[model samples]
Target: MSEKNERQLRIVGFLCNWCSYGGADTAGVCRFKQPPLLRIIRIPCTGRMDPLFVVKALAQGADGVLVSGCHPKDCHYAVGNFYARRRLELVKRFLPFVGLDPRRFHYTWVSASEGQRWQEVVTEFSAVIQELGPNPGIGADTPMETAGQAASAFA
Candidate 1:
């Protein structure tokens, strides 16, 4: 995290409304520190996620994206996680096709009360991203330019 060129990787996080989102909220209320790198976007269900959203986040300068939802048998929407799993499988392939580090994307499940788990996940994911270094493709076009400009160009 201290390297001069180690860009602070912007991360977009998609969390299921009922579980993962609440878990994140709980973490915050409990003061469980997690990396500020992530920007959380709550969705009605994991099934609501579109592959386009993932691509767009990456294109817009997010060095990584994380998707969290209810566990397999815990989804309030019953099958939302199932659909998400299937769709992300394709995203997994597409990341590599575009020369992105496939490790930039991560998926997990966090229940409403799992504040500790939520914190742990963020810690691990952020660590991995730090290890991978910054996403060169997103900022390669304009290293000295404003992040917004770079993101727009990538997008």
Candidate 2:
């Protein structure tokens, strides 16, 4: 592996802006250390996440994916987190159909005030990804080899 790839695991985080994202920001501002592997993408709400996008990231060679949003009863947008929970659960159950391990994907809740919880969440998830290592991908090409190209396509 190249030095760059060796330096960071390909872990993607799709965080809801109103809650999880803020929580992460708080972690940073508070100087609570987090793993360097997690690359964050702030979304309006987890309810807006498309299952396909999570699959696509894994297919493109991401070692792990984390989707976090507001707590169930505390979503800024009412039932938004509920919708996200349902979709993410369905996707988690069927990861094997796409040749990905269910363990590679995770979803959870963290409010804006939960900076310490955010640190714990990221640390735990990053360890899981490190244990899993690289994904060889479903097809002939390996994810590590094609991830750069595929990641750019989506970014």
Question: What would the TM-scores of all predictions be?
Answer: 0.83, 0.84
Off by over 4 Å in 1: 1-6, 138-155
Clashes of each: 0, 0
Residue 143 displacement in candidate 2 (angstroms): 15
Which numbered prediction scores highest in lDDT against the true structure? 2
Residue lDDT tens for model 2, 52-87: 788788877788899999999899889999999998
Number of the top-ranking candidate, with TM-score as the measure? 2
Worst 10 residues of 1 by lDDT: 146-155
Q: What does candidate 1 score in Cα RMSD to the true structure?
A: 5.5
Model 2 accuracy (lDDT, Cα): 0.83
Cα deviation of 82, candidate 1, in Å: 0.4
lDDT per residue (tens digit) for residues 81-124 in model 1: 99999888877776655556779999998999999999999999
lDDT of 1: 0.82
